[model samples]
Target: MRSVEKVGKTVNDAVTEALIELGASTEEVDIEIITKGSKGLLGFGARDAKVRVTLKAPAEVEPQIEVISEVKEDVKVANANKETETVAPPKSSKVKNKEKKDSEDAVVVTRDELAHVQALAEEFLYKLLREMNIEATVKSEVVNNNRLSIGFEGKSMGVVIGKRGETLDAIQYIVNIVANKGRTEYVKIMLDTENYRARREETLKKLAYKLSKKAQQSKKPIILEPMNPYDRRIIHSALQDSKIVKTHSEGKEPFRRVVITPNYQNKSYR
Candidate 1:
């Protein structure tokens, strides 16, 4: 594999410099952080971050060719044998038409159906808030004709948001269930307050980057705190393009956590 080392003010900068030198995308290389540079007090002991980027070996295409050759050889042998065998007859036109119709019958939400789901979600959310004695106005919007985004507004929204938006997530889950009951096409429901969901997503993305850097620097796996599937997805997506670290989740729901590990093979680095 071809490799190059570069230095910059930060890890991202160093990785970018190395990528430019190697003319490779993130998916085509494995990156190792040699040093996570620091900004010392008063710029007296400042240091630059250093990274080594190695281009990954090209994938072998010979195995696929071999498999195809084996299949062809089997076919040739079968033809040579010329043994009498029972063959199943082709399906009737009615059977084929029925199969096609079954496939085409897949449920799709129309504009009216989307509006119905939106109203149902909004109504359920409002009633739930009232029962909790949290005075908040529910606003709903349709997204992509199959998703509903519900927003809560009012001074008492902090209660609705709850700790880390757990309460909001639970409410959204229930609202989706209620809205999709007796419906063939499922509609997704998203609930948020004070832009909490968006803000939390941003925070998770930043944390993903920081932990990725730490994983590369320490050359070890970093297990993050437990997060819901939604938050876990945010972390995964944030580092999906990174060549230095890879992210995955483990454990069951409600306790599942994101794990960040350095993406490198068992090889010595210069």
Candidate 2:
């Protein structure tokens, strides 16, 4: 990701200038505050605020496909050799339970219903944006036959994406409620502006790695600032495979935080 540094009257101004240079939004880049400028008395020692903004890396899809292809090849080889084997191993209980749960959770909806829900979600979003006096284009897509992904494009998205995306999340929550008001089978609705969701996920993953290293080096628990449940999940998943540290969340909603602790029992950490 490319990064740029800018100086302005305040941190927000510096970040805004940086974003304008990158042609990106606040959600699309990670901002680091370098200095909070001060307005000196009589303007003798005034200093401008400086900030560094870095564009986030794009999502990786090719690597996942390669991994899946390798797994399929292994499965094909196993199937080809099955005839010569005297016996085959049974599926694990975990696998069986998972399959059963998936079957029970699967809900079939007609094409008409899908279209209706999509239109409903889009209409509600348009009205909401109109009421907020923000003009933006709304696009919706069906993902995995069960989720609706909506994207927005326009100016002043920082208002829609409030601090840490609280505003965006609240919008999504209301949309979901309106869309599934009387439906027996619920469809998930996800909202994004300027690719905020993806960019935020990338930032959280990077933070997880950094904090994990800090915990391991210091041999102490590192508590992150409060994050929503969605963000906390990203942190936990990012560090789930680490050999030097473990992660978990503590506290109540809106104030819950993730804590990364060094795994002292692990030889690598010791």
User: Highest lDDT: which candidate?
Assistant: 2
User: How would you encode candidate 2's per-residue C-alpha lDDT over 36-129 as one tens digit per residue?
Assistant: 9999999889888999989876542112324334533543564575521111112343465568668644867667777889999999999999
Please, what is the TM-score per model?
Answer: 0.58, 0.63
Count steric clashes of candidate 1: 0
Off by over 4 Å in 2: 1-105
User: Which of the numbered candidates is closest to the native, going by highest TM-score?
Assistant: 2
Candidate 1 lDDT trough over 10 residues, lowest sum: 83-92
- lDDT, candidate 1, 1-270, per-residue tens: 889998866776677556545544454578899999999999889998998989887662112324334533543554466521111122343465567566544446799998888888888877888899888888888775556777889887877876557678788889989999999778877888899988878776766776677567656566555556777778776776676766656555545555665666524212
Model 1's lDDT to the true fold?
0.68
Give stretches of model 1 more than 4 Å off: 1-107, 265-270
* Colliding residue pairs in candidate 1: none
Q: What lDDT is reached at residue 262 by model 2?
A: 69
